[model samples]
Target: MAVLVGVGMLVAARPPVDVLGSFGSLLQTFLPWSGVGVLVLLALAALRRSAVTAVAVLVPAVVWCSLFGGMLVDKRGAGAAGGDLTVVSHNVHDGNPDPAGTARSLTASGAQVIALEELSPRTAPAYERALAESHPYHSVQGTVGLWSTYPLRDVRPLAIMPWTRALRATADTPKGPLAVYTAHLASVRVSLAKGFNTARRNEAAVALAAAVRAEPLDRVVVVGDFNGTTDDSALAPVTAGLRSAQEEAGAGFGFSWPASFPVTRIDQILVKGVTAVSAWTLPRTASDHLPVAATLRW
Candidate 1:
């Protein structure tokens, strides 16, 4: 049992989709306490004179914590001292009835740049109109859009799929050109035969990563409902080079899904060639997912 748990914990520390990612989100609320639990279990086994069990449990506990302990720290650092940008990302569930209210709440967040996904044709116009007053410069392609206070240029739809799957726009900020990507990767649904159906999501991630890599801009921000965690191996193509704003500056795990009772952070704000001073999840609104905001500096 100790060996099994040890192996499981090791595997879990690796990435999402493994037995660990599949369950870690559920256990993260008590991650620090879970560490204590592992220690206690090891102690009990030793007290019971089970040396092998004790070692097995103790060894894995130490390894797992050492590997991901930084993630448990509440950095909450100031946005890059010279940071010049504020960005927000959210998946405004296409079927949401309170599109106007949702738009109001997002605009109130005071985000200088906003990237949204899962936009429906019916609601897109409303969101565009609502955001226009604040973000005068914006671009939309397919179901994704980027609203910015800075001038937008080189707007293009990322061919993440043979069909459109993401949007990319370059914001000519005073500092320089910042490439912004808004993508709603294919959602993964679980099944007995497929376990976690991630083929489509993986494909989209690869395509987006390739597009970002090929862009001419030095500063890039990618945001939206990735439908998978940064820990997921399928997102390695993107995660490998970019930094998650929440992980860099957030006060906690920053979960943002199932807004009523968020358990995982599928929404993300990833950046490269810029500093993330702070990152946080916004209050719940009419949508099923909470918005994620980040403050950054060049």
Candidate 2:
């Protein structure tokens, strides 16, 4: 049984079938959590006190470490001392109970660039009022918005969904012009009947990726609630050419959803041609999702 478990993990490393409602993507979403299996195997090996079981346990342990061990070490500080820009992304739940307090909490981070998703007309006013002092330049297209301390230009809405759920803008920072994309991709679901449903989110990801590819700006920053992790194959279209801020310079997984007890990272700060100095998740606000913040050099 121990050997079989290790073998199963090795098989999982390769891409699995996705025809059955994106089963492969679903597994990939929580692939990091598979390490827990190794712990169970170790306990079993200890109880049996068999050399064979001990050797079998080593298989999955090595595989899990090889897959995510690097993330355990601290890779920050390269750009930590002096970063050219700071950005934060959050899915401030539409049904949040305290919009004013949430906005205040976000502003306290002092991120120069902030992108928010799931914003409704009623709650947006509170954000606008609270951010007016620090992030003077702001743009909102439908449910998504961008607030920045620098001047903004060529602000436009993206057609990734039926209604407005994404936007793009050019931030005129001291470094240069940066194409900033704020998006809230269609949410996915999991059910026994349909398995993992990601068709809508996959289509939106393709559209978003196309926009990023055609962007003329040399520096680009994509911040939002992706609804899928970078590991999920369904999001490859959008993550193919981009670098995740957390993977580049963060201490751990940096999960940002379910503010009470986050298990996976859905909100992301992905960049192209911008150096990520540090990436971290902020304390919970009134929103269901915790905010993700990153500092960039250039």
The sequence of per-residue lDDT tens digits that candidate 2 reaches over residues 1-298 is: 6667667666665565544347767677788898898888788778989788888888878877887888887777644457998899999999888987888888888788999999998888889998999899999899999999999999999999899999999999998999999999999988888877888999999999999999999899998998888988778889999999999988899988789999899999999998898888989999889999999997
Give the 10-residue window scoring lowest on summed lDDT in candidate 2.
12-21
lDDT of 2: 0.88
Worst 10 residues of 1 by lDDT: 25-34
How far residue 71's Cα lies from its native spot in candidate 2, in Å, is: 1.4
Please give the TM-score that candidate 2 achieves against the real structure. Answer: 0.96
All candidates' TM-scores?
Answer: 0.85, 0.96
Write the residue-wise lDDT of candidate 1 on 80-106 in tens digits: 343688899988888988888887888
Looking at model 1, residue 174 earns an lDDT score of 86
Which residue pairs show collisions in model 1? 16-231, 79-277, 80-277, 83-297
* lDDT top scorer: 2
